[model samples]
Target: MSEQLPAPDPARFPALDADPSWVLSVPEGTLIARIFRAGGTHPVAWHEFRTFGPLDGRFDPHPLPVGEHEGAGVLYGVLERGRGGGVADGGALGGAFAAALLEVFQAQRMIRLRDGSPTLAAFEVTRPLRLLDLSDSDWIAVAGGNSAISSGDRERSRVWARAIAQRYPELDGVVSASSLVPDARVVALWAGAADALPRYPAALLPLGRDELIGVIDRIADRYGYLVL
Candidate 1:
């Protein structure tokens, strides 16, 4: 179970309103494929994928086998118009984020997103990912700041989050405390877990394909949300 915290207050997050309104789940394989394909061309994204850690705000690239990031989920996040630079909706972005079910089969992989210059860098979590998701919910607000969102007691949050997710898969990505952005509240799980994880065992994510689909379906029924 997670530690008790104050109930969420949406009022504190006025800034987030302009942030990403919805999240599109990308499967682990997709990200691995992206990393693999981009390794030659986009070495920056690939290296960032290899040694990106959010526990502390720093880029200490470490080399490891590609299998290390096996269970990681590559999130092709969605952003709508009129929010945070009015990033447009659909197009390459839409096609990139529509794989909630494929993401479930992700084994021992996890990814962390960082707002970098002209692009977002995907950092690989060393810990075995227990759960992860994309959402506008304010359940996991930890502190306010650009770096605070990514480096606070993130490991603690991940452990607690994973336990909760195991019981309620839909809640897996609902409430993560780790932050790699200047300001972020939602969570994404298991696309880089294997690399940093001590074991090579099959990825044991909080939710399977069916459970993730349910969460996706529920969110889809709501307003201001979309899978792609």
Candidate 2:
């Protein structure tokens, strides 16, 4: 039987209160994963895992093959307590978990989200994603999709755009998955366009779907804290 690993701690990591966060610069056909850790502080971490050509009905629920452009994948990790910490030997536990996950990706031939959405096949892991400190209102502005409450209309867009600006006041503009504005500090994830929305001035992130997942696991292993 496989050994059970301890869960993450909560006191160290906190939960994300903001709804509708945005991930910008995702390459076309890339998969994004968002893992939400229950009962923890700073429970949110974004990872850009792998890139794949396309997905082939291996994973279920939201299975969609990669488009013409190379696709990328992302994952979110939330740390909760009951997990181990302060381990010796350079924390092999986390490294082992990451390696095992990679093996699974190769065997399954794809990565699936908690909702069972297909994201990536196989790729590499990138740098760790750190969420900047921003108010809940500002988070909603950048992360939240165009909704009845925060529509993408001229007025609403301006409102949302303003929120983003406030958070990263220093930024020239905001970029979202689909839209981009020069001198802005927000971007959205646009899978169809295979390109960043025009107007925003931030670096575009081109990655594979699987690469996203790898990053999520790493965060969960490294900084994830615990309680009790």
Candidate 3:
């Protein structure tokens, strides 16, 4: 049987009332975007710090993505902006979603262990990853018929619309990212404008989209956060 993991300590993120349910080491290139894929909910295999991203040929005991490796616990931080009225759009779901949640965990000052290490020294997660059923439709809505557009099936977008409506009736008529994640208590923590939205010109952006040193200007104007 797999070992039962320990849980996070409350003192890490004071803003959080309880310790994180899962402590994860995030890979590089995870962006907090507004992904609205239509269809069935996506499943993410819980990650191990070592297996979180890629191997650095194992010679150095660290991974190739040395720069982006960071650690964090999960939380249901309130979704501030959904799809409109100047709020940041809902964050992307799936692997990106899980990584986005990690951003909040890394924000804490106490356990800043993401200093380019290949493997996390130790960690804990309260719940069984098997129990986690994460879905993009659960927290985000489509921005347009093309929100979930796919080249695979020309009618895939229509099918997804019907499915989304049938699966999540409440999200019907939701056309913007803001409208989708209303009152969404996402796995997140408090952050400055960096995590909020870009406020300056893209050319002036140093990292362009690194949540740690980046910002989204006037959240309402745009919401997609996926790097690619």
lDDT of each: 0.29, 0.28, 0.24
C-alpha displacement of 22 in model 1, angstroms? 16
**lDDT of predicted model 3:** 0.24
lDDT string, candidate 1, 1-228, tens digits: 434333223344333224343223333322211112222343443323332332221111112232343232323221111112110232232222222222221222222111121122223233333332222333244221222223444443333333433333332133222232222223343334334422221222222234334543443444223333
Clash tally, candidates in order:
31, 66, 16
Stretches of model 1 off by over 4 angstroms after superposition: 1-37, 40-151, 175-186, 189-228
Better of 1 and 3 by lDDT: 1
Number of the candidate with higher TM-score, 2 or 3: 2
Of candidate 2, the 10-residue stretch with the lowest lDDT total is: 177-186
Query: What lDDT tens digits, residue by residue, belong to model 3 across residues 1-228?
Result: 422212222222121112232122222222232211112343221121222322211111112343433331111222222222211232322222322223323324122223221111101222122111122332211122322232122133333333333333221121212113323323221111122222321111112234422222223123433321
The best candidate in terms of lDDT: 1
Which of 1 and 2 is ahead in TM-score?
1
Which is the winner by lDDT between candidate 2 and candidate 3?
2
